[model samples]
Target: MIETYSIWNLHGEQVDHASSSNAPRVDNVKPIVDPNDQVMGIIQDVFPFASTNINQEGEDDVPTPIDSAEFEQYKKLLKNVNQELYPGCESFSVLTAIVELMHGKIKYRMSNLCFDYFLGVFKRMLPTDNCLPKDHKHAQKMLHGLGLGYEKIHACKNNCMLFYKEHETLDTCPICNESRFKMTSQNRTTKIPQKVMRYLPLKPRLQRLYMSTHTATDMR
Candidate 1:
């Protein structure tokens, strides 16, 4: 990796800067999905503005910068960030609990069952004064309320392709032709994919980055 440095001749102070090779790079371009536009169609359905680039007149296709008014709308949507988990709960808010739980899960590599158990225990300990979720389901619902819900996209077990758009009703992988649903004696009627992928929407998350004053300033 290449590196660059600046030195003050008089004071003998030196500062180092990363060269192009060493500097961190972020991919800003939209990802290319299925050639047939199936995945892109699904994404556009969820977020109508996701694929919007050109204006109503179909002018140049480019990213439309968010103005101050648009930013205010996003702020209004996320105004409940400081909402308390329960009435009179000052130590922990809904957002705080969610963040802490997520951090704990990642830091300790906690499983879903383990997370559920801990949440249940915390709920019992706090009694009626706390609104800690009873399990992962409730926590997920809370996230949904805050516009952060994840999408469950069924996928082929053989890593062939996702079941979406034109392939939405297909029972098998288009490429491998493998059975999509696993064999189950108990729930034979209920069709379940052999593998599932969780997709978290990025629009609200991007809006969240501009919610805070410091972060918003940096973003600008």
Candidate 2:
């Protein structure tokens, strides 16, 4: 017989065991699974955009520039993980949850600012598991609109919120109504204080969504 292990959710609220006998435990947390109760592998740690780039000795390097290829790869990786680990989660909910995990307490403010940067473009981008095709014309348009073309955006360790240029202005989100939100930035980086921002708080809806999606998957 194969040995099994228990997996923990993001909140550390509950534990689910692995379906496969071969799953390994790194940190306490494991990846989400499907309804059929199979081990989908664990959620890979969210790759920080800042770590991808290297600076010359004594030279400062900002976050790696956002390119279409990298963005598409990020999306596919996210989608695959979602399908295996968090099956029932709406794409938006999953993305929001990941963003929340990335940003932690500052999700709201980051959401507001990011919402503004794309003129609310994120609203439409939501509910998508990063599976959009690379050649999709809309993707290019969206990237261009966000000023993401050839520019780098970094996620703050505090809340997973993304930052482009420091001290920027936000207008409107193309996807959601502007009246539903408010925005701000909390700079937390000591070295690049101006360039960094924190993550936002997880809203009640998101919390519920996360719980509902992972509760059952934990059992297998």
lDDT of 2 at 124: 48
Q: Name model 1 segments beyond 4 Å from true.
A: 1-89, 127-130, 201-204, 210-214
lDDT scores for all predictions? 0.65, 0.38
lDDT (Cα, tens digit) per residue for candidate 1, span 121-159? 888887587667789877765544334567998899988
Q: What is the TM-score of each candidate against the true structure?
A: 0.51, 0.16
RMSD of 1: 14.4
Measured with C-alpha atoms, the lDDT of residue 128 in candidate 2 is 48
lDDT by residue (1-101, candidate 2, tens digit) is 22443443445555444643466666876766442222122222122351334567856567556677656756654454354223354533332333323
Which 10 residues in a row give candidate 2 its minimum summed lDDT? 36-45
In terms of TM-score, how similar is model 2 to the real structure? Answer: 0.16
Candidate 2 displacement at residue 167 in angstroms = 29
What is the alpha-carbon lDDT of model 1 when measured against the actual structure?
0.65
